[model samples]
Structure formats: C-alpha cells, structure tokens
Target: MGGEGENMTEDAKDPVTYEFRDGAAWITLADAEHGNALNEVGAAALWRAIQRARADRAPVVVLSAEGRFFSVGGDLASFAAADDVSAYIDDLADALHRIVSELMRLDAVVISVVRGTAAGAGFPLAAAADLVLAARSARFTLGYTKVGLTVDGGTSLLSATLGLHHALHLALLNPVLSAEEAHRAGLVAQVHDDDELDAAVDRVVAQLVTGSHAAQVTVKRLLRGAATPAPETALRREALAIREAAARPDGQEGVRAFLEKRTPVFPGDR
Candidate 1:
C-alpha cells in the first residue's frame, strides 16, 4: 500500500499538490484552508493521473480530499485574480470534465470516499464514480447556483443519472443531502461509518481485483454503450465490444480453462 500523498511545486505560486500510489491512483484536495477549491493545475494533474491509472491497469482508484469538505468546486480566489475569466473558466471546465469522462470510460473501477461535504463540482466528481462510498457524516450539494454560476464537470450528466425531476431539484434548490439520503436517492452507492470508510473502500477494491480483467472491461464497455443513444445503437456497440473481447487471447484461454476446470492463464503471464 503505497502512500497516495505527494507535494510538488509548480512554477512558484501554483504547486501540484496531489499524489498517485499503489494500484489505486488518487487525488486529494489538500488546500483545505481554501476549501479544496478546484484550480487549473489541480485539474490537469488529476486528468493526467487518471490517464496513468488506465495505462497501468490499476484495479481501483479513489478520489478524496484532506479537509472538512471534499472540494468547494472551483477556486474563486484564483478566478478573480485571473486576467481572462472566460478562458480560465473554459480551460478549467474542460480539464475537469475530461477527468470525469475518462474515469467513466476506464476499465478500472473508481470510488469516491466522501468524508464530509462534497459540493458543486465535487458532487458530480463523486457521482461520476463507478461506485461512491460516502461516510455517514458526508453531505452533498450542487452549490453552483448559490455562487451565481451554471454547472460544469458533468454535473448535468451526473444529475441526469438520478432521473430528470430529482436532478432538476438539485440544480435549482441546491440543498445538501446526507450520505444515507444520497444512497437512497441513487446518487451514492453506500454509506459507511466515517471511521470505517477506508476499510469499506479496501474491501470493494479487493472484490474488483478478484474478477477477470477481460470480463470487467467488456461489461464496462457494454454498460457505457447501453447508456448512450437508442437500444439498437447501444446493442451494436455491445456486439462490437464483445466481439473484440472474444477475439482476445485471454478470452480464448478463459473459455478453455473453464472447460478444462483449470485456472485461466491470462495474456502476458509467465
């Protein structure tokens, strides 16, 4: 279990303040004094880390913050200091959205371990995870409207996953929901005692690691395909994805192993 904690200096003022570790890549919003506000550098770091996690075939990844709140969305202080608000906002949104979208497309499972408050972009980032295990003390809110701005970072997509009416209420009302409520509303997968969250996450990750990588990737692609376009179109993607999986050497080995009642020898195994 490598430590998912790193401190890197970027330029002179804006430093890269997150870390990736073990088979589980992670990004922690460490600027707690500023509410773990999302900034351009942090967003880019997270995006790159996600890419790394995919290339390395990490079993599971977790996103958390080291503070009372997960993140207060974007860093208002940096935005106000920027000379070009429009460009900054666009760049920030693009990076953040890319991270979330990539997480969705990746084969490895992602989990959000929300300890306390996860508001604005934080909420959607959590929602984007394949699984969200929120601490009993965690609370979530789409706090964009309260700050006089529209949503970003797949907030709309995350909201839509919970159905239209509930999403609309979240966007319009911006009221916070307890972790248990979030689970009941389908926003989060489970809620654990704050002290037991790390163990719960570890168990989930272990379960994911025990499965066949080929099957996991195939199913993930199928699910994503089913979510997009009409059933006919989704079925086409599913067929294509399954066909590709079947053609792989590992898939062939798996079938043969099942027939022979032996363990499958996956590709690249010695």
Candidate 2:
C-alpha cells in the first residue's frame, strides 16, 4: 500500500481533496460539516480529481470521506438557494455524471469506502465503483424521493446491478440498508468492522497494486462491456430526470423544508 505524500493538487482546499500515493490515488470528500454534501463547487472539484486520477494512471483509486458520513448526497441547501433550480441541477448532474463516467472508464480499479450514511446521489456514487467496502455500521439509501428529486450520478446502473425489482424498491421506498443488507443486495463487495476498515481497504489496494495491472484493466473493461444500457445512455437519462425534478414545485418545497429543518409539504400533501 502507498503512504500518503505531499503531492496534493492545488485545488486540495476544495471540499474534495486529492492525494497521490505510490500506485494509488486517494480522493477524499472533506466537507464533513455538511455531511460531505456535494454542492456545485464540490461537484466540479470531484470531477477534476477523477480526471487527475485517470491521468495519473494509478493502478488503484480509493474513494473515501472524512467524518462519519460517506456523504448525505447533494447539498439541498444550495439547490434551494439557486435562482434557477433546473439549471443548478443540470450543472451538478453534469459534473457528477462525468465523475461516474471516469470511474467506469478508467483502467484502474475504483474502490469506495463507506463509513456512515450514503444517500441519494451518494448511493449511486458507491454503486458505480468497481468495489465497495463498507463499515459494519454503514447505511445506504436512495433518498431522492424524500426530497421530491430524481436520481442522478448514474443510478440507472443500479437497475442492472441490483435488478429492476430491487432497484425500484429502493427508489420508491427509500429504506436505509445496513452494511449486511447492502452486501446481500450486491451493493457492497465486503463489510469490515469499523475499526478494521482502513486496514482492510489497504489490504485490497496492496493486492491490486502487486498484481498484473494490465490483466486487471482488461478484465474490468470486458465486464463493463457486458453490462447493458451503456453507461453513457444511463448518465444522459439520469441528468435529464434530475433537472426536470429540480424544477418541480414539490422539489422546491422539499429542498426548502429540508434546509429549514422542517417536514416538506410537497404539493398535494394537504
């Protein structure tokens, strides 16, 4: 495993921080104050970090976050404050989708380490990774509907990964799945004790870095090709749906209520 070095990017000050170590790239969501939510700036920074990781051609990329939460999803406070909600969502989706695309297309293996909660767009972020390692206490949810928003971050891929019925169940019910449940549903590749997570992740990365990089890359590409609906197509649909939902009255109310720490009274709630 690679030790952290001082080769941090200039944009390391952003909510998303990037560090290159040995043969791996470590991308951490550092905005713990807000549950590591992705605002427009964070989204853009993450996209750029992903691009840098690909350019570095690291054999392994580890995505993790500071604080208890992996991420609570997009920053709804930012969304509620935007003058043009639709445009705001479109921009967010654009950056996030690019990040997802890069993760899928990169020759290196992408790993997501989930600790606390992964919700909304966060769910897709974890699901997009080639391997997801979750702490025993970690939880997952597709929380889009709670905020009257639709899915983004290439969640359409979930249909293929979790099957149509299970995917729809998640999308509609928004139940939080524990690490064990997530692994059973194929969302997480492995679960580790909270205390052992870092070591477990390091072990996996060590194995990858020590193995045949070319063979790993070839296998990844082959498996991705075998998946249906094409990542590009799924991303496009997700972007459009998110934009449309953000423009709805219910979406607006939901975001506002969330930021205000109140129950959302969506249209027809009365």
Candidate 3:
C-alpha cells in the first residue's frame, strides 16, 4: 500500500531508526553492532524520534529492532566512561524513566513487535506499550539484577501490568520466556512466525486505525490511567471522556449510522 510507505532515516550515531508509514510510525533499534544495545546516543536518538512521531500526528506507533536481538539493554561501556559514574547513571536512569512514562502519555496507541531476545530495559519497553506482538523466536527476561543493577525505567509499572507475583518472578528469577510462554503469561498479546512478524504488526496497526482517532485516544488515556487513579477520580475521568466523545461529530455519526443501518463517515477520513 502506498508503495510500502516512506522510510525516513534519522542522522544520529548508534543507529536509532524510525520511519512513518501511512498512519503508523515504526521505530526500530538499529545498533546491530552492539546487539542493539541502549547506549546514551541510542536512547537519546529514540527519545528524539518519539517526539517527532508525536508532532507528526501519527495514529499508531510500533517499536522493534533490526538484527536477531531486539535489545540487550544498557551500555555498560558508556557508563564506565563517564567522569561522574554515579551522576551519569542517575541522569541516564531519569531519562529512561521519562521515556517510559511518555510512551503511555502519548495520544496514539504504541505497540512493540519483538523478535529474538528482549531483555532488561528492553523488556520494560515492550511492557510499556499499549500492545505487544512477539515472534515465536522471541525471548523476554529481566537482565538487570543478574548484572548487579537495580531495575529502572518504570520496571515497577511493568510489573504492575503483568501482576505482582509474575513481575516479582521476572525480576528475581530472570528466566527467559519464549514468545508463546510470554503470551500465555499475558505479557504478550500475539505471537507469529518469525517470517510473519512484519505482517502481523501491520495487521495490528490496521485494526487500530479502524477506530476513529478521538475514540482511540480516549480509550488509550482511560486504560493507561485507570489502574493508577483513585476510584472516584477514575470514574470522573471516564465520564469526562464520555461527554467529550458525545460532543464529537463521529460520536453522533456512530449513533445515527447504527439507527439508519449505514456506515458512519468520520471526519478526516479518506
């Protein structure tokens, strides 16, 4: 479709790749030399691309990586090079936390398509997504504790997403789970063959775009914040969203289309 869409390259070291196609944006870790490791340059590049995606009005975002490794996580060499090692680590940690939190805050739905190994911060990157599609060849684990490092980048929030006991197990045990096992444990939503991973991600993006933009954003906000908000606050948030939806033209069209037995023509739709 549309000649496979445009693949825009960003100029930055360490290979942080991102592309915008149709209504979806894809960001893949391109640092194959280091097993797509998350170095300071790579992390900063990703953060910048994400901001670009937000500004571009993309309806959906997908995260993946080139090579056999999705990401091996942090770059120890970079940390070792810093003059103030502890301060550098703290700053890096803060950046990662902001990145993770922003993934949920972005209006569009974000999905992670994992193939091969996704460990440490990489695992949490997938977890922070609105949805995750993993290839049968994929593996997930928490590699932080094994490396004598505490988890960061909203690892606690990822644990909350996967539930307390399982989250604790991932952190403490650090055992790798195959894509099938991940799906079974509710960590991944869909699993496909290695050859079919790209198509599967496209299918998800297509399904995501079927909903009106407003509805998608509203649902994303609700789901992202619901578990963290107070009961009364959550209810109020939902009610406010409902009121906004009812006021949108698509909302009225949806109701009228249901009554008239015809499809609703949403605004900004081609």
Q: Estimate each model's TM-score.
A: 0.76, 0.94, 0.80
Give the lDDT of residue 68 in candidate 2. 83
Q: Write the per-residue lDDT of candidate 3 for residues 61-98, one digit (tens) a residue.
A: 88888888988776666655667544565566656656
Better-scoring candidate (TM-score), 1 or 3: 3
Off by over 4 Å in 2: 1-4, 9-13, 268-270
Separately for all candidates shown, the number of backbone clashes (residues 3 or more apart, or on different chains) is 0, 0, 0
Q: What digit string (tens of lDDT, one per residue) describes model 1 on residues 1-98?
A: 23445433343233224345544666555667767778887787667666666665676777777779887777665655567554566567666766
Candidate 2 per-residue lDDT, tens place, 15-113, comes to 888888867999899888889998888887788778778777788999999988999999888887789989988988988888888888888999999
lDDT of each: 0.68, 0.87, 0.72
RMSD (Å) of each candidate, 1 decimal:
18.4, 2.3, 18.5
Shift in Å, residue 208, candidate 3: 1.4
Q: Report the Cα lDDT for residue 201, model 1.
A: 83
RMSD to the native, candidate 3?
Answer: 18.5
Give the TM-score ranking, best first: 2, 3, 1
Deviating ranges (above 4 Å) for candidate 3: 1-14, 229-270
Cα lDDT, model 3, residue 124: 79
After superposition of all CA atoms, the RMSD between model 1 and the true structure is: 18.4
